[model samples]
Target: MTTPAPLRFRRNDWLELGLAALAEQGPAGLTIEALCRRAGKTKGSFYAHFPAIEAYLSALAGHWRETFTLRLMQEADRGEAPRDRLLALDRMALALDGRIEQGMRRLAQLDAGVAATCAAVDRERIAYLEKLHGESRCFAPAEARALARIEYAAFIGFQQLDLGLSPQELHDCYGTFMRLVYPPSFRSGPRV
Candidate 1:
């Protein structure tokens, strides 16, 4: 008989799977059996990875935060201009809207642990943005702080709108908002 290919999996496999499911279906759909089935792993594997369902969900939130930070920083690194850099950060937030709307935010609403993890992620993003703003000669320290808060809030509001715009459209809308909020020096080039 032909031997089956060896199954290779890591301890965190289910946690990753759980996050994806949560992103797709929300916390209500993240039952243990659902995750195992979605992951193509056994219940034993889930048990081996997490002591309980709550433990797995907590791990999933941490995973989401790490992933969000990495993506934002990567985008921020790509722009040569500070204004462009901030716009890039806004793009990252737009990219996250679908995942956030699908389930993660709702999950946080019901679970304090999940909410704290999500808040931690938001705090980290804001702190990073604040540092970027402070470093830019384009704006005074107070202005930078205020701009960061405005940009952050605007991005969140756009995401909540579920307007279903393409990424380019989202960026353009944000760019327009930035122009109205910041001095001319801080306006990025046309956001096409």
Candidate 2:
């Protein structure tokens, strides 16, 4: 099979290559040699930026956190209303790169550093959801927190577990989930 075409790699280029490698083959596939081949570079180039594989992995996790989690959270917070915000979150969830998500999650299982970072990401997302549910629904804090946990769990399960869903189907499922979790007042009609 034809490999990725030849390309020049710069400082951030390694991070891009790491992400693509993580997406395609999980963390196990991210190596200096593999990335060098994929980017048509050399060990000299890789070492120029990363002193060792651990450093590269650290950078990879940081890149994913900045690009994916933080960006998605910003996108989801753009709306004024709770429904709008939650839908924005659903849209972001639906748009996540499952391959990268799965790869990172698997890495978390085997690597302590990755696991801590992944846990932090999860905690941030769950906290955001919890606050949204608590504020919008005015549920008891415990109930709202539970709802948030459920929502995030479902998102992780759907994406990482290889649930067979066409894009449209997953979209519908997420929409349905959001609707189900909406506050009763919000669901009936206009916000009360």
Candidate 3:
């Protein structure tokens, strides 16, 4: 039989490979050489998708923001109620690759574009959380805002902690926080 054609990676394929590299090897792993090796492709393949390293990095950040933050928010919004939305968001967030988020945070320190992307993601996430909390009617506008910040802070902190904490443990901790901080009516709703 004739040999099959060589695999060609598309733009999104390169982006996805970059995310896996980040999760496995951190920011340093994002080098063109590293990524090409991981994909078993050449520099030409990468250049076809990205003009330069800076552009590739920006694209990678955008990819991360789209996949991790925006997509999750959209999916969570599909829930029928605010509490259901919150729980769905929590489950989705917890299921994400924390290592990739940690790598993005690490990259943010060195890249202004990445930093801005991270900041935007943080703002978007908090705003979504605030909206969900307000819709739940468990807290006033200000309280919802504050609670959203607190919740987002916990998520960021938990991702960066890298203390071998499993997602289930994080989810349980979040459930506990919800029980303790949420109103009695909500306390019952957020139970794990």
Candidate 4:
């Protein structure tokens, strides 16, 4: 029998290490040399996986989108009430503390390619939210879309606030915002 090829580090392994580096030290600090050091690999390995730095960065964007989108969708599918699903998503996003999202957003501001990737991710996320809203029948389509926008904005805004607020305070604030933004049709009725 022919001998099998020895195990080799995959491109995803390098990309994951690069993403970790980006999270720790923003996009500006991300360099191939640093990434290679972190991954304990050589420049040749990086080159073998990606054509160039830009290609690596693009791959990073795709990785982030896939990771974030999957988490959100998984939470959304957890059989909770519609409103609860949205709140769970808000909590999950907050839990991330916006590190990866902030890194991607900053990169987008500086690079057109990154910007396009970020936009595509946003569009995909919004479409997913729209579908959830429709299936839940929690609110009219327009209202659901509007609430989705509000939730997204609030989550991002709180990240930018960087006020070091306690988690309880953040949850309370989110609850209040949800009450205001969600239509009555979407809310649970008063407890008896």
What ordering of candidates by TM-score runs from best to worst? Answer: 3, 2, 1, 4
Point to the candidate with the largest lDDT.
3
lDDT of each: 0.72, 0.79, 0.88, 0.72
Report lDDT (Cα) of residue 115, candidate 3: 97
Let me know the TM-score candidate 2 reaches against the reference structure.
0.89
Which has the higher TM-score value, candidate number 2 or candidate number 4?
A: 2
- What's the TM-score of each model vs. the native? 0.82, 0.89, 0.93, 0.81
Residues forming the 10-long window of minimal summed lDDT in candidate 4: 1-10
| Per-residue C-alpha lDDT of model 2 across residues 19-94, encoded as one tens digit per residue | 7788888877787788887777779888988899888888888888877788877887788876677777777777
Candidate 3 lDDT (Cα, 0 to 1):
0.88
What lDDT is reached at residue 82 by model 3?
86
Worst 10 residues of 2 by lDDT: 1-10
Q: Pick the candidate with the highest TM-score.
A: 3
- Model 1 alpha-carbon drift over 4 Å, by segment: 1-6, 78-81, 188-192
Candidate 1 C-alpha RMSD relative to the actual structure: 4.3
Error of 4 at 154 (Å): 1.4
Window of ten residues with lowest summed lDDT in model 1: 1-10
What value does the lDDT take at residue 132 in candidate 4?
Answer: 67
lDDT of 2: 0.79
Task: Return whichever of 1 and 3 wins on lDDT.
Answer: 3
Show the lowest summed lDDT stretch of 10 residues, model 3. 1-10
Error of 2 at 83 (Å): 1.6
